[model samples]
Target: MTIALEHPVLHSTAIALPARFQASYTTRLVAVGVDKRPSDFWLETAGTPQAGDVVIARVTAINNHKRVETPESRKAILFEGVLVMLAYGHRYAADQFLAHVPEDLGPCHLVAAGGIAGTVTALHDRVDEPTEIEPLGLLTNARGTVNVRDFAAFDNPLKVEAPNKRAQVIAVLGTSMNSGKSTTLACLVNGLAAAGQKVAAGKITGTGAGNDRMIYHDAGAHSVIDFTDFGYPTTFKLNFAEIRALSVNMINVLADSGADTVIVEIADGIYQGETSRLLRDQVFQEAVDHVVFSAVDALGAKAGVQELQAAGLHVAAASGVMTASPLATAEAAAVLEVPVVPTFDLTNPEIVTAVLTDHA
Candidate 1:
């Protein structure tokens, strides 16, 4: 094999590689190209690669502060391993890929734990710079350039069906990331399970991360899915049609999974482009039977609730970081005219029963 002996093959669960490519590789054959863009690659490495196909690249840079999220929600712990990143173009975030995949296989950055690869053009002040990495070579052999699309769930084609009325959907929205959307959904899943309802939960938007899915599983959800399952590393750049199709397909998948209730979470805030668009879609709105908005403070909670109400979604309850503070919860509840359930009380099966029963 004529591959460069630069980086070792360090498999990261972030990309689902074929069994053949799982072995230790000192050197391997690689057909390099310079025209493919990052957005051209899939999240998994399981398919035949044509001239424009994207392959899994072994990122050589490892920064302690920048860790990759594994499929099971475990961190790859950068210092000890090489990061496998997906080279793709991002629309909403600060980083993006060069117009074309570099034939030289030079340096790049692990822009997202979900294995998004690109050059860091900009970043929020709060986050450390993206962990830099090198594109050692395309993870490939005699077959072709392996692409993330090979292992994607949508490989089978996601045909969206009408809303499944048999299963009630509890859509959880948040004012922003880290606003306790995952926590609230986990608690609600636990509570619903305790109430003897088989629950299926999924994170519909945002970047691909197993942490939220793991939370749902730990909360006793019978099944959990996310946008990653639909072949997207992140939902930031997806068009409204694509987002709408993925959202509807995800809900239907959960409903078909035999879940008595489906708990769906749309990442980011109501004001986010994708979130706002989905909220405004009449069909998407109909797919959701109940809405629980999460926020950081009383004001955010009130605003989030108003956003939902204006979109024609009935805000069932307000929860999240605000609920941690009794005063904030009370204030939000008063203004929003909705019960503010604290995180600790979320597991109380009574709360789940009350909400579901009331909605029923």
Candidate 2:
């Protein structure tokens, strides 16, 4: 079987294992015990193991976002090499995994860029099928078991206290993943920084990945962070309490980092599992001074605004792919009764300043 020896997750953690070992399927275990902590799994050459178990696997194919994170924060080719990834048991908006692991060594899909191991159940028409890989074996230790959580970085509660007074929080919420939340945040950061304001950016939810944070940094954010900084491979189906605490701590960190303004990106649609629940939380709502809504289309824009309004949150303005089309922006602006700012205007400090000033 092919072997993948390069993955950023391994270098980020202290978990060490033999160069190689036997491979098997335990996706069902991860699915059933979704609530279990990552460190609680048994990574052995022989034992009853569950999902979230770290395993060394070899890439048999490549597709979208065909590069993996390297230890130096650079992207590396993911063709035919050994890598460590989390055994993901949950469904995604794009693809999903089989309920049980395959009985024998075979091909499976990389369901997420964060290195979630699973079989693809479906695909969006725009993208090709997922990259395929073969689980070579569990990277065993002297005790003969390997676990992904062992090498996981930031696998502990954030030690920050909620700020007594938070800097103005400009939160970016979207209609769906890839609907332009990160881009909007980047534009906001770039513009605010250009205007001589200290901007701290954060991704409060979603799978662990450094791409969004990198974008924010490049856009001139004074500092950037994500849920991965708190030890989660992906935030899918995470408990409400932990997720809420994470949001609070994230804001606190940015606020305390000497930021005058903080732009936090909330992943997925406003109605998405974590996003929806978070919007409804008093603590979460109280931390935000302004809400920037993003959507792919006019209908989505209207619906997003209505969702937030229903949750007693006021939207500052609308922006995203829908704003890319003048007709769609006009329609959404009429429906939302709010300005529909295009991506370009998002980088205009005056435009953002007016939006905040008008709302303030």
Candidate 3:
């Protein structure tokens, strides 16, 4: 049992207690359910509550009719945690317990699951959302190229292998997290697919909810996969081999699915952590194809190139913040001995060829 918090992982809090009624489960029950909320049977377990037990719990309160400046009508859920309404996803009516969630990057308002207690359970399926890693069925047809429920993530509307053509694999590497790695991949996929290339995309890092894949699909990628695609509640405590093997397996799977170009999105910076970082090891360095360096500015971009190339790898293209100005892109590329691609929307399709063509 592991929980993802504070960017780094803390195994200490990931308790795997066999919750028994009035035993180990007592503390959790007292901490979870309270107030006028309906007492649920399916949400609560009689004996020790396990990880996947659906508990109809309320959040501790904030103030009533709380005012949020963001205008994304939200209320602090008692007990569960916080629920945030992302700009995307199923629009909930007021009846939805976690209704007032926002459309931005904030904490969840209600962190617990709601439903009749003792609804149903199998050997595996259970509760979710930042806690248990139970794979549940999607109530609605997933709207995007990827489907993430609990810890299980998979490509939505699976792609069939056509014409006996092998899937083209393209792995995107960034200097760090939130550095436009996915944004650049989205652009690349658009360019490649528009040029008649069948694109399959996925992310390798164990962070970020769905920001990376949203554009990857909107930009024209066919199928997308990420760590969430696998049954991982979060990427915490995983070893380097786990990350590498997961990346390799996802690419291989996408390749088997017959993608002309399987775009792999690497989460976090190349140098972020031992478990998620790929650039720190020599073996991992030799396994990758092209490295798409994403940084904040010209100087940061230049620094990333030197650090990566010094590890004996080629810096394929530079992207991210400097995409607005070709001059900033050109300066970083010159310093790193690679071409610069700064467009966020796949404006130039030829850029993919410059980085991937064997003619270098």
Candidate 4:
């Protein structure tokens, strides 16, 4: 098999690969859905890059994200001039950078460690500039520009039918980024698994990163998947309709996995654009059976609970970073009717069963 490179500077037309030459592209986790065999595709220098379009780029400068997560979920250190296989996608990280897919395959920033390339529009004060990369070109084949959605694990058209034997769906939401949502979700998974319940987990939203998914798997979930499994690098800028479909699809997929219970983590906070929309959507509300709100403080906990309650969601309990503080916990528990279960307590099967079963 032969691979060709199409670049005006390199050649007037496509050039064939040398017989001894081999492609050694470092494929990122975001492109894990696509086949990694370089020989299966070629590089097209012409065309506008769109969201989810796979691209081959070289690191020009290192900054915030010094390493890129690989397809194997391993973090590979990045260096100048290192060719990487990533996807063009938008990013929304309040603690990091807010980025959008570029109009062309021009120089952009590595907005996410999960291997998302985009143009950084805004960033938090504490975060350094995003790592810069020069887009070589979009990956292409006989079908034209390759997209992550082309290899989605569940690509069937959206059919939001109620599962006949669906698992109990528990959703974990937080006040904001790093509000302990993933931790709470993991502890819940551990506790439920410890209680002898078959559990499946999915992260329906958020940037394409493996940290939360890894935590869920380590917590003993029978199966684990995220938005990446459905070919979305991030759900930041997606419309409410798209987000709703993704949410329902993920829930149905996890339920169909044969687990008795499905625990899902909704990335970001209650106030996030997509999160807020999902919270208000009738379909989303019907899909989730219980909600666990995570917050960093008493104020956030109170506000988050109110938001969930207003959305007509059943708040099971409150647990998160605030659980680390006795005063904060008491303050939140006093103002809110829901019990403030500490993170450690959440890992106790008895406590978890009581909280969820009582709510049930």
Candidate 5:
């Protein structure tokens, strides 16, 4: 069940591998972009591993992430000794593990169910230890090491421009992770589509996962994409310039999809490293026409709106977990100048469209 590859040194020619490989969800978009599977692999014992380098590793233990999301989005249960195809990447999750790609192809953890392999540097108090894996080799082809960047959809450099003339860009920002950003965005997409508006969406940041992309598609988005489409397994330690360029490219690509409106979500919270810089950057502020802020509570909603306003970005409305509680919604509405739109109201075409139109 193991594939044999000749090692350049010591004349070694074999390594144990699973007979059937379980491709991770992060590889889904890459597969589509590359149009073919990797035909070869080699154990790079000496070279440093880079973000997005595809690795085939054997699961050494199961812990927090007991399952790996497959390319098909199925949560496939993992067992010790099973081989998983994942990409090396850095991760920044406030409620989970903080991880980075290893310097060498040694043992690491499956930091994300989305198929990211990295060494955990820190973990949230509530989060269990990450699943462990021993990398077997880097997946490769005729060109060399197979990195997600090799199959990126937006490989070309993009020049930042005004928001597309044909599309109105509405960006959704959150107070923090799990603040209902994706839900708000999906609801907005549904509402817009219900009103007969062609809607396209993208998640320009965050770890590579299929959940948000799937939600967008199910919510009636005519076109959907995320960081994964651009070859990033996660946008954890990316710089402001890199993130800004990504934003421009994502917006441009979504706009070109013929949608009249584009709704993009910025992953993580406003205070996160890249998110904070992006909010303050003139380029990002000018790229989007309006912004919807999502937060978990009234205080967060108020403070988030104020921060967005201070950043020279238009605050269209506020929504998120706080809307689920009538008292919380009332409290937010009492102090905030922006409308506190509930998830239900967000789905109402008239209400959602009015929010956008009023901000427009």
Candidate 6:
């Protein structure tokens, strides 16, 4: 079967195959090969693709499998691998044909499905291991030069085991939205990971925006996750009791992530009532190993720690404030009698050690 030049086979969104393939393209293709693991292609592709995207490839003739059936009347094609959706669903937005690899890499095929393909940029053997990042990406709806799409939590409920069990769990809480919760989580994750601790980071509560967890991942955490990944548009629907349960459950999941340390984020502030009330819940207050509070002012920071301690909750360390306000950090540390490490001074070993050791 001859292939046309116009039909570019996309190896990835970034890389298209070289030119059109020879006449044997179709004969060498298979919709889903038996030998290649269905899950491999998926795990390799997550975190890179998104939903409503196109993927083109020539079919190998070895297997005549029924394509994921989509009635002609249907608006779009749907691919199925028993574990594909559940496996990579939350990592990246993916909508395309599914296939196994460790097979032949014949000529690429056609547009296949989804919206139009973007320009091909890369095509290398996929990686199965995770990588570290800095300045975790925040999910945002508003437009900008850097941000691409508005991030919203999956519109449903989800449950998974936390990433690690023995890992130290430290959650970063903030006084209000945009108060640097994400930024602080990143720094803490990086510091912990650099200290030889395997860290899995997450944002368990918030408006359910996306960028914050991205920040955690970028910060050097071995694995990063969020409430959005847990399938919630925001934490508003979650009562304090729910968050308490979630915190306990999520901490366990992160612990299972095989990391020596875990960073959890509570969006908004300790005084936000919802956030504060949630953390102080017996389940969370008991399970959490540490708490990093982000404050807008010294008084708020002081009060938040005092209240959490008064309620018998753990206070890990204080980091992140709007400006260069030593007074605020100092006052917070003085009142709480804990280290008040600032983001600007995140690199200090003494402070970091104090945080890692003292918090736990």
| C-alpha TM-scores of all predictions | 0.78, 0.78, 0.57, 0.92, 0.93, 0.53
Worst 10 residues of 6 by lDDT: 81-90
Question: Residues 1-360, candidate 2, lDDT per residue (tens digit)?
Answer: 112122223333223333332222222222223223333332333333334545555677787547655323455556566454445434346322222333433466666655556666666777777777766545444444444444443344534344566588989998887788899899989888877899999998875566788899999998887765654556666678878888888888788899999999988777677778989988888888889888999999988888898898878888987888999988887877777899768788888888877876
Better of 2 and 4 by TM-score: 4
lDDT of 1 by residue, 86-174 (tens): 53435244222212223344576666665555556566766665676655455443344554444456432445555759798889998
After superposition, the stretches of candidate 4 with alpha carbons farther than 4 Å from their true spots are 1-37
Model 2 scores what on Cα lDDT? 0.67
Over 84-157, each residue of candidate 5 has an lDDT whose tens digit, in order, gives 78889999999898999888888999999999999999999999999999987876555767798887777636
| lDDT (C-alpha) at residue 269 in model 2 | 76
Highest lDDT against the true fold, candidate: 5
* Worst lDDT 10-window in candidate 4: 17-26
Off by over 4 Å in 1: 1-54, 58-65, 80-106, 139-145, 154-161
lDDT (0 to 1) per candidate? 0.66, 0.67, 0.46, 0.81, 0.85, 0.47
Question: After TM-score superposition, what is the CA distance of residue 240 in candidate 4 from its true location, in Å?
Answer: 2.0
Better model by TM-score, 1 or 5? Answer: 5
Better of 3 and 6 by TM-score: 3
Q: Model 3: what TM-score?
A: 0.57
Q: Rank the candidates by TM-score, best first.
A: 5, 4, 1, 2, 3, 6
Tell me which residue pairs clash in candidate 4. Answer: none
Error of 3 at 244 (Å): 2.2
Instruction: Please give, for residues 17-92, the per-residue lDDT of candidate 3 as tens digits.
Output: 2222110111122222211121211121122322222222222243221211111112222222322111112112
- Clashes per candidate, residues 3 or more apart or on different chains: 7, 14, 39, 0, 0, 42
